[model samples]
Target: MASAIKRSRTSFLTALSLGLLSFGISSCNGAWRQRIGIEKQPVAEPLPEVSDGPRSAPLKPGDNVIVEAVDRVGPAVVRIDTLKRVASPLGNLFGGRAPIQKQAGQGSGFITRSDGLIFTNAHVVEGADQVSVTLPDGRSFSGRVLGGDPLTDVAVVRVVADKLPVAPLGNSNDLKPGEWAIAIGNPLGLNNTVTAGIISAVDRTNAVGEGQRVPYIQTDAAVNPGNSGGPLINASGQVIGINTAIRQAPGAGLSFAIPINLAKRIAQQIISTGQASHPFIGVRLQSLTPQLAKEINATIDLCKVPELNGVLVIEVVENSPAAEAGIKPCDLIRDVNGTEVKDPSQVQLAVDRGRVGEAMPIVVERDGERLTLNVTPEELPRQQ
Candidate 1:
């Protein structure tokens, strides 16, 4: 009986071990199938498309500012076309009688008054037999050159139109570097082209040429050919300068504009007197270089100072403001209206800021003594 009982227990133990082994093999096979990706994964349902209606993203603050400025100032910008006569080179080769050639040129301008008064660079309409002004609205009219100042390169034109859009003039003296600048003009024959940039510099003295009297505003704006005479506007859409000349070199990124304050003064003079005249102190002045100072010190013995830092009066015009104010040749100009000046251009700029018949205080070093003299400037005589 004991043997039979023992045999039954052994059989049960063996059966239980086989059952566990079978279960382990089934689990391993299942895991292997999953690891090899033989087992299929449940498919995910497709999501519905999101809809937000037809509205687009709002413009950024900078974009809004630019758009506002353009809308405000675009209508005042005008296209200027000039017709002039030129002598053909081929005709000159044929005979002494050269054939007359007609040439058309284009530039930009802005309306300054509602009665059709326009402002532009003097060179734009210089020697133009016929000037045609086209408004932004595509309306065209004949324009008459009222006046032009070549030194400042400012001109005025009058069109026979009423209720014209005019650009407001801004104070250029308030301009600062890094301020926003917008240029609206016709660049390279493209009408009403707009360019945006920042004011790179202010109070730039010499840009166009040595004779340019007005201080220039320098910018990185892309001013190309045919952009001359257009308005350089501020963020407020007011004209701060007039686009004049651009430096055309690879990677130069230099462009210049005439300050609107100076241009406005010139334009007002042209409208009132048919021409612009700058105030002068009637002295031939030259910058005091080291070599020039040495020459003057050797010859005149008046500028033998330790360090000369001012313009030297080379010649005082006879019976002029300088002579009348006791300023003589060899006198070193130290200051104008209490502003220290180092170059003759500074004196010119000071005189330009003053009105005719206005007394200007000039400080000079005469014979090792500082002398202050009051001189009333007169209008510069027009060239004969």
Candidate 2:
């Protein structure tokens, strides 16, 4: 009876041990499967919930805005492909117009008025023997030079079109720095290309032309060779300026445009009067800097006689308006009309706004003596 009881106990112990071993094996396998992500159930963490918030604004692009403008004004914009036959000096000396060599150049223009009056840069069609405009619609028209003002680098060309889309004109006086700007033209002969940027600056006066100084609107819009005469439009698609010049260097995005205000005035005069008159003060001026005052044997007090910041007359044209008004060398011009002159540039700008045959008040300091002279403004000759 004792032997049988012992046997039963041994059998129970063996069964219990087997059951424990089976549980241990199962736990080890489960852990391995979970670590390796091989279980029927997911072993990885759940993803975080996403919120429905607005996305951030994108960075402003330099080329895309201009491209957009080009798209908007596509039909109105035209390519001026011109063939200029230069009279070869040798051919001119040898007589017979040597088989005219075709020289091609590209420029851009926008239809300003509904009558098909296109405005472009003067340099584009300066001496072209034949000028033709190509539209985005694949239509072509013979263009005639209505008028050109080289001083302002603006020109008017006429084309025959039944109906035309005109670009909206913007007031340049209202253009401010940091506003959006776009340039559209046939840059590098690529028709209807647009370049975008901001008005990096405004009223820039570093431009030199025909031995004269011009205040220009500076922008960073990537203007290239073919962009000359193209429209620089604001966000509202209004023409703000006419793209004219660009610095020819990589990363040198310094480009200039003729203010639409000035261009519009010149264009109107060109279309109606056949010529535009630019006001000019018949005198060469040197800014009244300390060094300049010293060089001219003038004192700061005497230099201040003009009641302006800049130096006065360096040379006055004989019998010219300045001389006629008793303005002489060493005479400090303090003001024009009623505007105070800050520098030669400001004086020139003020003079440019005046019309020919108008009388402008000139306040000058001569030998430390203040004098008010009523100078009769004269129409500068077209040649000047």
Candidate 3:
């Protein structure tokens, strides 16, 4: 009986030992599998919920003026394409008939009236045998040049279209420097390109090119090769100026535009008479300077003359209005039509406001005496 009991105890101990070793081997395998990423660990509980706080108000439609202005005026901008005939160099070498080649050019313009009247730069359609206008909707039409003023670089083109979108004209005289200026045009053949900048200056004269009497609005906007004649809009989506010339050369950021006030006047004249006219005084005038005043005072001895701040006449054309009115060289123009004159532009503006055949009363200080002279201005002769 004692031996059987001892065998039973030994068997029980062996069975317990076998159970413990099996559990240890299973645990070791599980650890190795976990370390090697062959088995996934138990997932942890989720984190507590947290709030991000209250949301702010949504943005208003008027928050973005640029986008609004573009949406308002962009459709009025048009692309102008011109084709001109050019003589081919190879024609001379071939000893054949002078070869005629079609030269294609592209520019920009804006509709000024709902009757399909468009305003653009004169140089855009100058010498073009054919002109084509393309709207933002991809519709193209053949355009006819109504009139062009090469002096102001303004031109009017008409298209036979109804219900055309017209850009609203603004008072350019009310424009102040540092205001927002938006330029929309096809630049470098890229249609509907928009650029933003500030009005760098106003009344910029003689900065664009020679013989431009109208004061130009200078801006830093990216007015490129194809942006000419496009509208330069204000923040209210009003057309303030017509983009015209860019300062060409390296480091070029200076861009100029014809003021809308002057453009409107010229366009009106062109529409009414099929030609624009400018008032001519028939004299070469120079702005008076301190040195020039001293030199004149020394030479002419114009005693009792008040502080000189006026334009000095350099030369007068023969049989011209200035010559007929006895306006000679070295005469200082003090006022025009009772308006005090300070610069040549002021005088120009006064003369521009007068009728071609109307008498213009001009005050000149000569030999220490201020003399009033009545001169009748004539229309400037058109260039041949």
Best-fitting candidate, scored by TM-score: 3
TM-score of each: 0.77, 0.76, 0.79
Each prediction's RMSD over C-alphas, in Å, is 38.0, 36.7, 40.3
Segments of candidate 2 deviating more than 4 angstroms: 1-72, 92-99, 208-213, 298-308
Displacement of residue 183 (Cα, Å) in model 1 is 0.9
Q: lDDT for each of the candidates? A: 0.76, 0.70, 0.76
lDDT of 2 at 237: 63
The reply for model 1, stretches above 4 Å from the true place, is: 1-63, 87-98, 289-303
lDDT of 2 by residue, 1-384 (tens): 000111111111110000000125786798889888897654654422111112223234556554554555656778999989765656645576574566888999988766678889999998888899988788899999988888788898888875677676777997789998888889999998877889988877655442333568888888999999988888756678989998665757688999988888788788776667776557766566554444434432323233335645656666667766677666777887788876666677777777676677878788777888767667666664
* Candidate 1 lDDT over residue span 191-262, tens digit each: 999999999998777675553477899999889878899999888777889999887668666899999888
State the lDDT of candidate 3 residue by residue for 1-384, as single tens digits: 001111111111110000000125886898899999999876855421111112222223587988888877888899999999998878767577678888999999998777788989999999899999999999899999988888788999999997877777777998888998999999899999999899999988767543346789999888999999999998878788989988866776888999988888888788778888777767666666665556545555323223456666655676676777777666778888778877666677667767676677888888778888887777777779
In model 3, the runs with Cα more than 4 Å from the true position are 1-61, 95-98, 248-252, 296-309
